[model samples]
Target chain A: AQTVTQSQPEMSVQEAETVTLSCTYDTSENNYYLFWYKQPPSRQMILVIRQEAYKQQNATENRFSVNFQKAAKSFSLKISDSQLGDTAMYFCAFVTSNTDKLIFGTGTRLQVFP
Target chain B: SAVISQKPSRDICQRGTSLTIQCQVDSQVTMMFWYRQQPGQSLTLIATANQGSEATYESGFVIDKFPISRPNLTFSTLTVSNMSPEDSSIYLCSVEVRGAAGNTIYFGEGSWLTVV
Candidate 1:
């Protein structure tokens, strides 16, 4: 069984600053995928970024990027030039090699202060 | 990226009653999934909604409790039968979009169910 862990329960970032949310997962599969998702008050889950284990390069999407360390089983999300809209519940997930099912972390509630 | 929608964005159901949550995707998809998110908890996958076939449930989930229907490639439904307060949670519908690896999953605006 694969499990994702998000150590931080809540986080706050000042507008225009950057913040990083930490994530770690335990899996036996050599090839897998990692993902970060954002859920606003609307309860709509939106994909932030994705990283493949085989890729040595990190994944970047606009202000959202991931620091993926496959050796450490660590995948973290970094939000740069943070805005108020970035305030939401962020979840880290792990997808196994065999199944499409995603194992999600407890989540971290982010607040961007202006 | 698939644009997915879930019907009855929210509902208040009485205990012992049942509610069916509908998921509709803008385009056809090969896989649809159902998930449950309890308050302050992570998303837990309920089952895989296989088009034209019966759903594949995860551990701790059963067909009798969460009956799912995937009549076609573009739509699916999940019903929570014999609802109770324990079943009160945000139900989410998701689809897998083909990506570089295989398929990336996306979720809909969850349907919040409040049972009392």
Candidate 2:
């Protein structure tokens, strides 16, 4: 079985600043995918970014980026220039190649303050 | 990215009554899934909606309690039977689209059900 662990329960960052959310997963399979999703009060699940296991280069989407370490099984999300709109619940997810089922972490509530 | 839509965005239902939520995708997809998210919690997989077949539910969920139907490749419905206060949560419909990046999962707006 695969499991995703998010150490941070809550996080806060000032507007225009940066915050990094930590995520780690345990999986024996070599081929898998990691993802970060944001859910605001609207109850919508928005995909922030994703990283493929085979890709050595980290994934970046504008202000959002991931630091993926395959050997350590660590995938951290860094949001630069955080804005008030970034205030939401962020979840880290892992999925293997064999199945499309996504294993999600407990989630970290992020609050961006002015 | 596939555009997913869910009906009954939010509803208040009575206990013991059943509510069915519909999901529609803009394009054909091979995989569709249903998820449940409690207040202030992460999303949990409820079942996998396969086209032209029965849905495969996850642990702690049953077919009688949460029956799902996927009539075609682009549509599915999930019915919650005998609702309770504990069933007051957000039900999300998701689909997987394989791209160069990988198999990415996209979700619908979600249906918020409050059982009173």
Candidate 3:
């Protein structure tokens, strides 16, 4: 069974500051994928970033980037120069190549204070 | 990137009634997924629908409760039958977009339902 864990239930960051959300997963498969998704108050989910297990280089999208440690089984999302609009619930997800099913962690509520 | 749209963005239904949420994607996709998100909780996958086969439901979810229909590559529907207060949730639709690197799942805005 593959399970994703996000220890942080809530996080706060000042505007223009940085914050990192930690995520870890347990999976026996070598080939898999990790993702970060953002859900705003409007109840719409947006894809933050994704990292493939085989790729040594981490994935980055604008101010959102991931530090993917495959051996350590850790994948964390780092938000640089955070803005007020970044306040939302962040969820870490896992998906294996064999099964397209995506398993999600509990979630970390992020609040960016101005 | 595909544009995914869901109908009845929000609705308040009486208990024991059934509601069918429709999902439409601009581009053809092989796999369409249905997910449920309870209030203040993470998203849980309800089932996965393939165009030609029966839907595959996750462990706790059954076909009778969440009956899914995938008539074509670009359209799918999920019906919540005999709804209750516990069934009040945001039902989301997702599609697998195969890219050069790998397959990425994109989500729709979601249909929020409140059972009273």
lDDT of 3 by residue, A27-84 (tens): 9999988999999998888999989899999999999999999989999999999999
Q: Classify candidate 3 by CAPRI docking class.
A: high
lDDT of 2 by residue, B67-102 (tens): 999999899999999999999999999999998768
By TM-score: ranked, best first: 2, 3, 1
> What TM-score would chain B receive for each of the candidates shown?
0.96, 0.97, 0.97
Using Cα atoms with residue i matched to residue i, what is each candidate's TM-score against the true structure?
0.96, 0.98, 0.98
Residue-level lDDT of model 1, residues B1-116, one tens digit each, is: 89999998999999999999999999999988999999878898999999888999999999999999999999999999999999999999998888656668899998999999
What CAPRI class is candidate 2? high
Q: Write the per-residue lDDT of candidate 3 for residues B5-25, one digit (tens) a residue.
A: 998899999999999999999
DockQ score for candidate 2: 0.90
Candidate 3 clashes between residue pairs 3 or more apart in a chain or in different chains: none
Q: Between 1 and 3, whose DockQ is larger?
A: 3
For residue B2, what is the lDDT in candidate 2? 93
